[model samples]
Target: MSQTRSSAVFGKRKEPHTIIIAHGDDIRHFTVRPWMAALCGSVLAAIAIGYLLATSYLVLRDDLIGATVARQARLQQAYEDRISALRTQVDRITSRQLLDQRLMESKVAELLDRQEELSERNGRMLPLLEKAAGASAGSADIPIPSAKPEVRADIAPANAYAASAVTNSAVAALARITKGSTAGKAGSASIADRADLMFLTINKSLREIESRQLEKIRTLTENAYKTADTIVAALESAGLEIDATYGSSDAGGPLVPVTGAESFDSEVEELDEALSKLDSVRDAATKMPIANPAPGRVVTSGFGVRRDPLIGKPAFHAGIDFRASIGLPVHATGTGTVSKAGWNGGYGRMVEIDHGDGLTTRFAHLSEIKVTEGQAIEVGQLLGLAGSSGRSTGPHIHYEIRRDDKPLNPVKFLKAGKAIGTLL
Candidate 1:
């Protein structure tokens, strides 16, 4: 009978009693197809998997973006720092270069100023130096002092002496007249005669004194003229164009017409001015490069302390010795005045040049003297022929440099040879 009742369950279940399995308040349907359940489970599983994947993807993307941003920021900062460092380095280099350039410019300007100052000084001193040289060369032409005419008390030498004799004769006549007269007459005559004689004697004596004073004045005037003439001659020899004039006067009792003390003071002032100019010239010359005596690269001796070749002892070698042929031409090291151009004790035929500023140069042991004393010479000009003169053992040029009477090494002055050659 239960089987017959179960037969209706296929299409419709008429019995109203519904059996429902419930989890909490939810009902469970058992009629669902297995394929549908399986499909639904699969859909839910796919949805869960998709949600998890999406969350993971978002998180990874955020991390990657943050890392990229951080890396970009670091790179930007590094680039900025590098730019700043490069800018700083560039600025420092530019500043240093500028400083060096300015320094060089300043040095050049200073040198130019010094050169100008020296040139002005040379212009002033050259004339005075020439005058001195000329005076030194021809001092024999000066005239000797002349003896003055003598004036005697009783007898006169010239017109004044004759006048004095006449005055004595008049005095004797007055004495005779007084002796011949009587007591009262003689007294009056003697008094008048004596007065007349006294006047004549006084006039004669005054005339003699005045004449002597005039002669002395004339002599002094002549002497002053001669001295001025000598000075003018010396100046001419020193290559100076000087206009000199002499004036004399025989007035004011035996007054000698002379170049006054004030004139001498003026000359001293001129000398001081010239000396100052010379100092400036010398300073300028020191800064400039000088020429060399020898042309070739061969140098036999150097300036400074060395073992003496002759004595084999330590000594201060003041000059540079250049080995050359006997007749080799020696040149002036700088522009200067030939101060001494003759033989010396140990230097043989030597030449000394004053190159301003107390700087002097000497060329010794010369076979020939090309330049004369007081001659103005230029650098690289032929001076003389080299020879084994003085205490030398071979044909060479003994060149010495001096400053303010003290010897200095010639090599130091010759260092400007290269630059000098280029300039020339």
Candidate 2:
């Protein structure tokens, strides 16, 4: 009975650790220890705790990573926005710089065109001044001052100094911006502003130069016009008839088509024509016998119907006599070729000069004839010595002027010669 009681206690301990399993239409049984059951329950509980810890760790890690990524993205966007602002500033400044350059180029071209126009005006004015100078000198008694004066200007020098100042100022400003890199008012000024300021001053200088040049041109033109009119009046007073509006250009043949710069004005052309006409009239006047052959000499005999000096009766006198001593020097009265230089009927030692336009003069009753026949001679040339040789009662010279062998009034010519002496 005591052995049975001990087995029952052992079996009770075993029975607490026994395990059973039920299968389809079958039963299965297993034995276990109390410690094993406790170990299994502890393992399952540990696995559950480990799974919960792992899930919580994954959730916290994902949340931290998302927060970090969001912060980084915000920082990148801000950096991109800052870069975009800088890029926009640079692009705006560069565009303004290019626009300013184009404007500067256009201004320069306009100034150059004005300079060219001024040059053209100067060219046309020069000829008129020359014309006035020549006319006043030859025709007027007292010469006047000319308009051509030396000119000096300070545009270039002033511009150079000013440009240097502007450039230096701009450079200094730019250097400040670069070295300081300040976002201040001084640094905000851009290259375009500097360029505009510099060019504005330059343009003002150019305009000043142009204004002065224009004034010079106007003064020159007025002076030339006034002096030219004065010359024309003086020329007219000298007995030179000038067709004031005549142009020799039309007197020539067909003009060749010119293919060059047509810069000259009508005033210059008129001056040129006046100069040519003046030359022609001057040449003609010089060749004529407008000078006295014998100055301060008295007329001993008169031409036309008068008493002959030798025959002492009323007769036709073809020549006039000049009272002189023996061996007096005689001169030519006009420019011509000597037609005859020998003795003739009733006149000894004769000299006949054949002037142009059928005008002739006879110097007769001379002691000696110095010019040969057919020899060219000028007015006021010494011809021979005067003496009583033929048809003369005393030492005298017979002078006669004729046209185509017909006698003309010699007194008229002698008076004209004295009157025209001032001009020659």
The number of the candidate with the highest lDDT is: 2
Each candidate: RMSD:
45.5, 13.6
For residues 288-337, could you state the per-residue lDDT of candidate 2 as single tens digits? 54445556779877889997656789999887788888788889887889
> What lDDT, from 0 to 1, does candidate 2 have?
0.61
Clashes of each: 2, 0
> How far off is residue 228 in model 2, in Å?
15
| TM-scores for candidates 1 onward, in order | 0.33, 0.48
> What are the runs in model 2 whose C-alpha is more than 4 Å off?
1-136, 141-265, 418-424
In model 2, state the lDDT of residue 175.
Answer: 44
Q: Pick the candidate with the highest TM-score.
A: 2
